[model samples]
Target: MTAVAHTSFVIERDFLASPARVFRGWSELALKQRWTDCHSDLAGRTHTLDFRPGGSETVTMRFPQGGTCVVRFHYFDIVPDRRIVYGYAMELDGRAGSVSLVTVEFAPTPAGTRMVFTEQAALLEEGQDLAERIEGTREGFDRLARELEPAPARP
Candidate 1:
């Protein structure tokens, strides 16, 4: 029998930008591509986003070694520059792998914006575990930090 495990985790980060700017990084398509895995070195990869309540986002990438992985996100609630709640599922080569509900809250700080991310997930026996997911998420956020950096003014 296949086993299903449940887990939840939270990560918080502060950005040196306004809450609106930070929120735009997630809501804007071009900006999101800079931080997310939309630029992976995969063949036949595609990413589409519709950032609104009840909207959906999908990303598919085929690994060079073998197999394809797909992630689909369905937005449940969105409060511009404040909060977002979404549910997502992962599939490996057309087989169901895992499902998760995620919540992100943005708050204004004296210096900039603070974001709190919470994810509750169910892992299938054949899928990755919570620790791996956490690590990947941390790496993604690290990339986001770089993406959020301001560009230098042209001479």
Candidate 2:
């Protein structure tokens, strides 16, 4: 059998919240659904997250065109308030699809938490190029940074 080759992308973002808060946002299903999964034009989509080793996260995104894609992540390790390591895959109607490794690290900062995310993925039959996928992933993280920001206080 041929082995799955991988490509990676790294992103760093600073949040104006405490490490614990940021970690909670990353781990908690409710907070994650707020900034994630619910964005973009995908309506009526929902996500379920089980934030622990051997736990799993599933997101089903529905397009306006009546198409749907489901993505799943199986957690391998979780370090409280610090890091998460997981394996991910995408499927259409429960069929085998792309696979990847995802790692997120959180570090305490004077302002708040410094969050870093890295994803290494293998293109399955879909055959997406590494560079294009990495660029798109970076954009997704950029959007997440904006989504996570709290509203500015009025003068």
Candidate 3:
């Protein structure tokens, strides 16, 4: 029988943008796609996001070395620019891997916004690398910083 390993983690970041702007990064399909899987090395990727309660988001990535990783997020609750709760999971090479319940809360800060991300996950047998997951998320947030930048002036 395969064993299941469970883990939980919280990641927080301060962005120099309003809560609405930060929420837009996750709620807009095209914008979300820009920062979603930026941390991964991929040969190709396709993303779809419905961005509403009961809707689902999916990202399929093909690796250069020959493997496919599919990630899915099912939105359960959304509070506009305040919070979002979702179910997250991963499938790699046809094998179901980790399943997670994720909650993201956004609050106004003195400078801009503080975003807190909390995730509780159940990893399938041969436990997924928790560090990799955390590091990958950190990297994604780094890329998201670009999303917070002010738009360049257009001539």
Q: What is the lDDT of every predicted structure here?
A: 0.88, 0.77, 0.90
Q: Which digits, one per residue and each the tens of the lDDT, describe model 3 over residues 48-114?
A: 8898999999999999999998999999999999999999889999899999999999999999999
Give the Cα RMSD of candidate 2. 2.8
Q: After superposition, how far is residue 69 of candidate 3 from its true place, in Å?
A: 0.7
Q: What is the C-alpha RMSD of each candidate to the true structure, in Å?
A: 1.7, 2.8, 1.9
Worst 10 residues of 2 by lDDT: 34-43
Return the TM-score for each candidate structure: 0.93, 0.79, 0.92
Best of the candidates, lDDT: 3
Clashing pairs for model 3 are: none
How would you order the candidates by lDDT, starting with the best? 3, 1, 2
**Per-residue accuracy of model 1 over 52-153 as CA lDDT, tens digit each:** 999999988888878999999999999999999999999998988899999999999998899999999988756576787898888888888788877979
Choose 2 or 3, whichever is better by lDDT.
3
Estimate candidate 3's alpha-carbon lDDT, on a 0 to 1 scale: 0.90
The alpha-carbon lDDT assigned to residue 18 of candidate 1 equals 86
Q: After superposition, how far is residue 90 of candidate 1 from its true place, in Å?
A: 0.3
